[model samples]
Target: MTRMVLGAGTGLAVAGCSREASALMDDYATVSQAANEPVAGLTLDNSQLMGIREAGLQRRVSGFLSREWSDHFVTLDNGAILVDINARALHYWSEDERTYKIYPVSVPLSEDLTRTGKTSVVQKREGPDWRPTPNMLKRNPSLPAYVGPGPENPLGTHALYLGWQYYRIHGTNDTRKIGRKSSNGCIGLYNEHIAELFGMAQVGTQVLII
Candidate 1:
């Protein structure tokens, strides 16, 4: 399967409502629809792609089918992030370049997490503090009150706060956890990957967790 790269073309130039905005929306819609379809002449059975078959995941995620970012997300045209839990990957769309770059990531282990949907980046911070939520504290009472920015900090060096309740996309001190299911309902990226993504993202950037 071809990588998820849209041809080099200009994306939304100026932010806000305009004709370009409408065209970008239409372009994304076309892209989304195409993703759901199986690519012709590609035999996925023996193909070895990044998101290829995992022992116990759904075919939609494990197969060669290109799972596009959902229609519910609105800012792919102006730059956005899509997190595919089953694939354990984050797709970063650069609005200016009109291209996407995939990064291996970690997601929540719990299957019951219901935070999947569209949301915007509410805040972004570097050298972020790690404050465990009350629920996280309940799950593990030994958690410290907070951890300041440093190598010991679980949030790593960069963090993007989500519009959803208490969720964030942040870097991790443990790089080994990337490309696995080992997070507390938040998206976890390698420190280097998060640094690059942080430079690409901004406040109000759309995030789609699928």
Candidate 2:
């Protein structure tokens, strides 16, 4: 139920009314806290969360998650979607509709760091440029490189700045690489899939990472 607004003044900023936000968070908490050792928000279980319930879904079923079918944008509260920047996954729950969807994605990271441990959607931009921060430069002395937006640019299509961190969950030129935990730290998503995610999210949203 985490609502992520799209096309806000900041462009891709997420917002939501408290009532709606509370419902989504509560549900997410239920899922994340299911095993008691919850992380931040929710880490979806392919079995219960996905279509792993039906007895007939054994042989052909792919753990309720796969490249097709469940491969869709997940909208969170206030018009935001829960983005798995590492696994390049998007998670959302249908509120009035009463259902949930998950999708594989690809996002780019800041050029400053050689790699990253994880990523988040804390900061956002319209056509953002990669301005390597001092800390980033500190990580890589030869950094502070300015990687602008465009084709051939490391930030392939979309860009979701990671708060103050020098990372982003954006689109990528690499389409073949998705649904895996691969990245210096940023989330890489397929071009079309991320577009669906970007369309579903906005600013001021809470991006909980596990």
Residue ranges of candidate 1 with Cα displaced over 4 Å: 1-77
Instruction: Kindly report which residue stretches of model 2 are placed more than 4 angstroms away from their true locations once superposed.
Output: 1-76, 83-88, 94-100, 106-123, 132-144
77-103 per-residue lDDT for model 1 (tens digits): 668787778777677776774555566
Error of 2 at 43 (Å): 21
Error of 2 at 109 (Å): 11
lDDT of 2: 0.41
What is every candidate's alpha-carbon RMSD to the true fold? 14.1, 15.7
Q: Which ten residues in a row have the lowest lDDT in candidate 2?
A: 30-39
Question: Which residue pairs in model 1 clash with each other?
Answer: none
Give the true-structure RMSD of model 1. 14.1
Number of the top lDDT candidate: 1
Cα-based TM-score, every candidate: 0.68, 0.47
Number of clashing residue pairs in every model?
0, 30
State, as a TM-score between 0 and 1, how close model 2 is to the true structure: 0.47
